[model samples]
Target: MAGETRIWTPIDYEADGKQSDCLRLPHSTDLSAYGWVPIPLVCIKNGTGPTALLIAGNHGDEYEGQIALSNLARETRHHKVSGRLVILPALNFPAVAAGRRVSPLDEGNLNRSFPGDAAGSPTQMIAHYVCAVLIPMADIVVDLHSGGRSLDYVASALVRPGRTAEEHEKLLRLMRLFGAPISFISDGTGGGGLTTLAAAAQEQGALALTTELGGGATLSKAGLALAEAGLKRLLKDQEILRDVAVEPASPTRFMTVRGHSAFVYAPSRGIFEPAADIGAEVLGGQIAGRIHFPDLPTREPETLFFETSGLVACRRAPSLTERGDCLFKVMADIDVGPDQVSHA
Candidate 1:
């Protein structure tokens, strides 16, 4: 009880049928001392079966997941489901409403705030609720994401390597089912590590998957389409949506993010000129981009190079950047052995 979340929901998760409500996160502000922030929730249940938790908008700036999940919440009906479907279109409501990557209320990044404290900020509270309540009730969890405001990414699905080989294989199968053009494996060192929603779900014995659809704070048509189609396919594969027809997933190129070398960061504040686009193959020491010092016209532009060889999975969207800002992230191909070819 000491570390339990303070948030309360009006809808009963155990009850059958379709229900739409909000998780009331207590916020004692100056306008209304007892007011609560409403985080939208949708639940569709039919009979006994596995439970799937679909989430998006972990970062407010990411639009693909939010749009896809919202459409899903509206279109999916209770009768169509054999098990339970839990949809959270905007998990971090404050950030989503503010159109920010982190919550405006507490400036917290939900994706980096998993296994949160009960008495933490609003974003942390939401994270805590999901980890303490929702994840335990789920058999599978999907957290949709994109590059957000700063970066643009090749539409991709990702999974953290599971604790056991069997678990890792299952995660890979689910990732392939999502059907994104690119499937990458995270070693949990790229960022967030165990603090991410995927890690939390995995720790709770649930298979978790995440995606990077598009970015620059704009809607990506390809990303949205991928998100929509993939969700349907995943639901069908899980036997949750009995009435929907889903096509078999296409082949996905497998990749992996090696340590810090996979990232290319700006060395100084300046305008960046990209040397490679997303999905471009480059070798280590190749010019990634040039940072121009517009203020000092005479100064030679500093050139940045890739530290690792791979495909450019994501790149900064904004031309102007600060020192240490990630300019590009390269993901190398996964060397699948003979035994793992069947999954690919």
Candidate 2:
């Protein structure tokens, strides 16, 4: 597998106007002798302006972003665009087709495979192309995401800390404009650059933002609507699509992930019974949940408590969970003005 060498693509970014094409990734299988995996992409260009990379489906089980981006690609007109817009609704086609979070070909989570190997598995190749070809061509990137099968979350936008004063401001500004009800500033300690696409985008010096709209292994109508509305507003905010009407930006609550304390993980394999609800505020040391051992009826269920006092931003969806699984995570409110953000 070539590392940083050039890779072939079926879509032309500079072709001009509106066009839909697939990124042909070479793959050989038992069913087809010289078959190639097709990644759907759409590019719309009107005149000279910045390029925006709009993407979804990094995790195949997340459907809100994929549906919204697909509808956007199909409905957007080139004449309405002042800059370039490239849409990739499904980056990991194999995973999406299989309804799994990671690609079955190599068990690769595309979100965690950034700066990947060129001649690696199908998932890694896609990640490598994104790092090599896509990021360099983008001025801004908006990656839509949500909690996958094992979890559910309140709608929110996420940004990593450690950016320059100017870059940080721009990042939060766009995230506020996203209007997802909650604006989250990541601790940067949980997931590093190579582990998440959001960090990868920031490493490339492009303004980046991601979201957690909804989850539970099912799509939410409200979440889908929110994604579509935010996608259009973000493009208009960037002036990529001129004359597009934007929805009024509602105020978003600011929150910070306070390292490991912000999350509560399952201690032993059991059925989870949550005490606090999503979006609800709670105090530290409060009972977050209890794990019941179904097999051992005589055993007392283990109780889990909150590590920090904050809002319930996310929770485990499936009742039956194993050891090492995350049970719930909290985010504390803070202050964020137009020019700056600080913890309250």
Candidate 3:
């Protein structure tokens, strides 16, 4: 039963054609002696070339990637593709179906489950297959994400640091090719390996590009277009797709999250009123917003200020705030090349 412990897809992996099927994960319950969880996936393959693994819906609330990916899965034909394209539009199927960040079945956060256990929970099994099986078959991987219901972000491409210098250069190239307005270099510093699908992919020698399109538990039109266009561009750039007119890569602003100072957190629990909008340039000591105490109508809202000056890359969407909640995350510009502007 060792082989039964791993996920099994219903399509022939080496077949040269397009197939859409569910990855079956064995599950047993009182209702059925043997059951299976169906995870949606699609594989498009032609002749020999680089394989690209495109994924989305790591968090169920983020919709841009799923929308764009579903569209691609339905419309993309094997005739135009040169290599394999394995796409999982909703990686965390249960979470996406529930429209929540974590899986309702096992309460699992998929992004945090890397190098997972085969005999683990539902979400962990999915992660285990992705880490140990699917990724090894790819030359590149792209995981699309957003701020979900909690935050909003400037449409950006993010790749964590720690890859070899050569791998880092490849990631940067892929990020630029995706053509998002801003490209972020995350060291994966404070995430504590929780936000780690891309990092895991990177470690497997796959040039991974992750995106934070737009969020609020709804899809963004512009963000979806960007995602669709970017995926096409990536396939073309990798020479995996033919007869595709690749769009020009937009000039990207290179930036990085320096450290803790790049974030501004709520001082006390209250309703937040933002002073600076997303994408706004702010000063080091600028007023970012205030947290209002609604219970005490007579009391003043505690004003919060930006600790570091830079472009407002991300901000909490919900007005309701709690102490230690991150109100904003700033990204400082870095020198990527001579042609790029000083982001700081």
Q: Pick the candidate with the highest TM-score.
A: 1
Stretches of candidate 3 above 4 Å error? 1-5, 29-33, 192-195, 337-344
The Cα error of candidate 1 at residue 40, in Å, is 0.4
Candidate 2 residue-wise lDDT, 178-230, digit = tens: 88899888735665444677777888998888889899989988889889888
For residue 328, model 3's alpha carbon misses the true position, in angstroms, by 0.8
Candidate 1 lDDT by residue in tens digits, 140-219: 99999999999999999988777777888888889889999999877566578778999889988999999999999999
Residue 156, candidate 2: alpha-carbon lDDT? 87
Candidate 1 weakest ten by summed lDDT: 335-344
Q: Residue 19 of model 1: what lDDT?
A: 97
lDDT of 3: 0.85
Worst 10 residues of 2 by lDDT: 335-344
Give the TM-score comparing model 3 with the true structure, all chains together.
0.93
Question: How accurate locally, in lDDT, is each candidate?
Answer: 0.89, 0.84, 0.85
